[model samples]
Target chain A: MNRRPVFLITMLCFGFAFFYIPILSMIVYSFNESRLATVWGGFSTKWYVSLFSNRQVIAALILSLKIALISATVATILGTMAGIALARFRKFRGRVLFSGLVTAPLIMPEVITGISSLMFFILLADWIGWPGQRGFTTVTLAHITFSMVFVTTVVQSRMVQADQAIEEAAMDLGSRPWQVLFDVTLPVIFPAIMSGWLLAFTISLDDVVITAFTTGPGATTLPLLIWSKVKLGVTPDVNALATLMVLVVGLGVVLAGILMSRADRRRDADARLAYQANE
Target chain B: MSKAYKTGWFDRKGWSDIIIGLPYVWLVALFLLPFLIVVAMSVATKTPTAPPFSFGGDYPLLNWEGYERVFSDGLYLRAFLTSVVNAAAAMLLCLIVGYPMALGLVRVAPAWRNILLMLVILPFWTSFLLRVYAWMGLMGKNSWFNKLLTDWWNFVVPVDWAVNSIPMMHTNFAVVLVMVYTYLPFMILPLYASLERLDTTLDEAALDLGSRPHQVFFDITLPQSVPGIIAGGMLVFIPAAGELVIPTLVGNSASPMIGRVISDEFNQARDWPMASAVAVALLVLMVVPTMLYSHFQAKSGGAK
Candidate 1:
């Protein structure tokens, strides 16, 4: 029976308050009637009305969703492969370099990555001329580079925890390597892959600096639009937009959490039934 | 063997090789190759024409002006100084604020842990730009939040020291404050991960020997969580140092951060070579801590 100290509990409360107050304030202020972000006017839904009609914001939101979806899917596939290679393969050619490449983006400053990525695209265009303009294609590619690193981390950690015996067992039963992968290894790490995809999706949607560098000529993402607006000053409609984003992303996360926990509970039940059958 | 089976002969080895090689190739080209290009561009001269920079132009093939300017110019030097000082402040503040929280999380009951962890990450799922914008609203002069803080300051301090607002917006204080808010989760998560794995029995045993909690903490718990501290510190420091949005939104332009300067050099000045040089310099600055973190990771991975 350990007595948890009051001081630590106080810090815990303070930490969560610090994290939430700005957000709670933003959401509350979004309903204000006044144009000023800080001042409270009588409650009004006018900003939300304006936000819905804003053509630029709507276009940017659509563009951002498209980029996030494409980048997240591609990043997840590549990241799963990279994660498996790291966790399952004992050794491989250029493993250190591969590992470094996978993890480095997680820590590398955005300014550095942005500058380099932009230059790479330019050089790439000059050489191959495939991605002709710096727009949707370019931004999606840039998002994939850093976003995949997050996917790699999530999948790699999950892969490490997964039991390899099941995979080996499948292989021993005359299943080909790909069959074992699809049947055993993939299923086991599927939760990690799903969460990793979500993380990558969120990162891509939230990005600004890399998107700014890589995008051009009317391919503004939501964050890029928000950045330009916020740069000038805080507007009432921006607050409304922020509140909506928080709602959508928060809902997605909660939904994912429920599904994962439910899946886990079912697995536990199945394992218990299997044990009883053996007895 | 049937002829059809010949294609499957190299299926295991070759297929796995391709599976592994695909990501490796994509990264080397996208991540590694781009980095090399930045290094090469750092040595190229700025031009007024398209591509924005070239080697062996009217000037020497290996132009060192960008690197030279980075070291010699007052703006670059001051920007670097601002970045380091601000990043260091944010890193330490995050540690101060995050350490106790992480410890509290570890000490809590097991059934509550997962839920609390999810709460910690929930904010991070939201757009980062919005979070900074929230601060912008809170810190603005006319805002209710600002008035509350200003009123408290006037009551605490002498009457003559009072001001209309606390001058929070467009200051280094604002930059650091927003950063501490933004990066606190990064600090807490790693610290939690490390502290959670610590042997709790060790704390209980030390307490059994009549060692005070603080003494036990400093001697036992603190040492164990040092790795967590470093991991969190690097995560906070490296990004905060080069952050663009938070600083640009909340920070003063007269004395800008390195990231703002890089953007200006690249966009406003149309000097890709200079931006690349500053980026290369930033990478060189970051490489040491980056390597230390990776080395720690490799060691821990190997031990596992």
Candidate 2:
């Protein structure tokens, strides 16, 4: 066990280097004045400037944000509901079916999901005359399908750990079911819901394969935009854009972790107080 | 109110449950119904005259032609094989690279654990497409990596390393590398979760009983961690098998994977039924292994 630390450190360093070097190279090359990705001439922020000014990149960012926000909200609501149903009412009929269908999107290949979704939408549009054409609506729908799975997993795990006694206590005290949920359950699981929403948002924002199959001609998301540009050749502008994304995502994760840890500490404090009171 | 009546499924209090159940009906309509449509479309005849490549008007049932084409075509079969090999290779690479890192993290000081875990998960937050693109810059013939290796070789070896070495870009190696890199966290996190839960006393006990470290690992640790390995393997293997983005970006057209072929069938080749057939086939292949693994795990009570 004592020898573990030295061996672990060496392995950790190797893993870190393997994962980080490629990313770090991209970041470093983003500042290079040379158009060539290999040879570095001098450092400059020209690529970042170019990236900011690129209309397509800007549009894609906006579109990606729109999709992420819309899908994350919708998926969170639905996923939370499903999670509650599964966690609270475990013996319900069709529970297995519902759970399987919901989680199937998680493991199903993206290409299959994308193509199937696209076909389904096109068929539905023809039949119902709604969601007229594949665009933001379809993209959001696809994103929600996958993102909801993550949200459900997060929410379900939290709900399982949640004490049922509190809700029962509230009900015993003459509170309505809705009131019990709102006052007792919702506040307890709110951090999990927030984490689920954030996770869903990130998944939606990062999706490319699903978006590519579902998105309309005019509605390009950031990943799709980046993919097309990358296909042509590596560009420093993309490097700049990617660097920005990496920073934003890193910050979001840190913030979420802080929020979760705070909630955990609060829960621990509440538990300790209750134990002392019982004694 | 009577207690039994109050707790009844159809009671007034259960109205909220009904409301909660409503959205899942919509989910089934959106997610499950679409898959059914794909299944139906696969069997239906594709009419060139139809606007969106009609699978016939009323009865869009099974079309053997699509299945036949996928099965009979050498190109499709080859791609399928390639996909299997590539995914397996990617899964192996992820395990080799990630297992140690995860083991290390679990053994590290508690203070540094969070930072290390965050670093492991950070790459996932970047736009997946951007991460794949970054590999292009790293693996390209004239890329920084190749240049750096060549420079290092010039310092040590007399021969030109760049010229002798096989180009990493646009090869199966590059595609697999990216796939492994992208999925390494998926492998590591689960392994770490399992490894962290492991009892150090068990290892110590084994050591006290005169077992070597390797013997202790193979006999106790590996078996205990089998569930994690299976889960991690499934997580990485399933998607990587059908991975489109990495292969499309980094892999050559000469040896496309089943995913790329399926995508091509839909987008460029205009063969929807064929794409659906391929999809179904791929699903069947994936489901078999998954089911078998679950069954074995269930029998052994190994999976939590």
Q: lDDT per prediction?
A: 0.87, 0.82
DockQ of candidate 2 against the true complex: 0.60
lDDT of 1 by residue, A1-279 (tens): 244457888999999999999999999999999877777888999999999999999999999999999999999999988888888776677888898899789878888888889889988888898678899988988888888888889999998898776766665567776787777888889989988998899899899999999999999999999999999998989999999989988888889889889988999999999999999
Top candidate on DockQ is 2
Q: Best-fitting candidate, measured by TM-score?
A: 1
Model 2: pairs clashing at backbone N, Cα or C within 3 Å: B43-B61, B43-B62, B43-B63
Report lDDT (Cα) of residue B60, candidate 2. 38
For model 2 chain B, give the 10-residue run with minimal summed lDDT.
B3-12
- DockQ value of candidate 1: 0.59
Candidate 1 on B61-134: residue-level lDDT in tens? 79889999999999999999999999999999999999999999988888988888888999898889998999
TM-score of 2: 0.93
User: In CAPRI terms, where does candidate 2 land?
Assistant: medium
lDDT of 2 by residue, B1-304 (tens): 5552333232245654574576587678888999998887777676674334554556534557888877899988999899999999999989888888888998888999998899998888777887788888887767758777767767787564435444788899889999988999999999998989999899999999998877887898877777778788888999999899998889978999999988998898777778888899888876557757756984685535
